[model samples]
Target: MEHVRDSFARQKAMTLIGASLASLEAGASEIRLPYRADLTQQKGFVHGGIIGMIADSACGYAAYSLMPASASLVTVEYKINILAPARGSLVARGKVLKSGRTLTVARAEVYADDGTHVASMQQTLMMLPDTPDTPE
Candidate 1:
């Protein structure tokens, strides 16, 4: 947990966007972001790209939390579906569906603070071989 929190704290983009790590566990994590006009689309809803970014990061970190200390992860691909306008503070919850030696699969769902589902994401991440410099 210390490592996970430390790793998350180092992500500058999360700080820049006012995103925070809300929770963390062995195979799960959540991030929250407040709604800011600067982060919205022309229609005043949170942009889909921001939603995707948090989703990806949340999922990636979830996978990372379960990885061995020497391993590192990189997202190989992901797909996201925006289902509703994100008009309020948002929370993205990510969970590992499968952890493999070479590949990992995770899912994330973003929801408006009001309980509206905003987006869903599925990600495939590659687990790189361990290296001495790996942070965790």
Candidate 2:
């Protein structure tokens, strides 16, 4: 998963939000983000958009983990459900449900620092198997 690690490291969005690649394995991946005031919505909880961002990336990377080294991916669509007010640090666990040649399905569940399920996301990712990643 070195490529996965490298790709994630180069993601400016993740870096901007202070997210880190916590773990990565075939068909599964995890991302972690520490709580920050700038990430909060008006109600003093993490913003829904930020939660979706991490969830999408988590699922996208999970699908990418199962693809060929040269493959590039894009999330065609994703549906996210925010279940609770997120506080403290967050962990998003992503798992691949199905891996196809050109389309993949994956899910990501976000948990609060206390382990409460705060959000869930499922995404459809399109893979370009012959496309290579951009240089860092």
* lDDT score at residue 47, model 1, on the 0-100 scale: 92
Compute the lDDT for candidate 2: 0.93
Clashing pairs in 2: none
lDDT (0-100) at residue 93 of candidate 2? 95
Prediction 2 TM-score vs. true: 0.97
Error of 2 at 78 (Å): 0.7
Cα lDDT, all candidates: 0.90, 0.93
Question: Could you tell me the lDDT of residue 123 within candidate 2?
Answer: 95
Q: For residue 24, what is the lDDT in candidate 1?
A: 94
lDDT of 1 by residue, 7-33 (tens): 788887899899999999999999999
Question: After TM-score superposition, what is the CA distance of residue 99 in candidate 2 from its true location, in Å?
Answer: 0.4
Q: For each candidate, what TM-score against the reference? A: 0.94, 0.97
**Model 1, runs deviating above 4 Å:** 132-136
Q: For each candidate, C-alpha RMSD in Å?
A: 1.9, 1.1
How well does candidate 1 score on lDDT at residue 135? Answer: 41
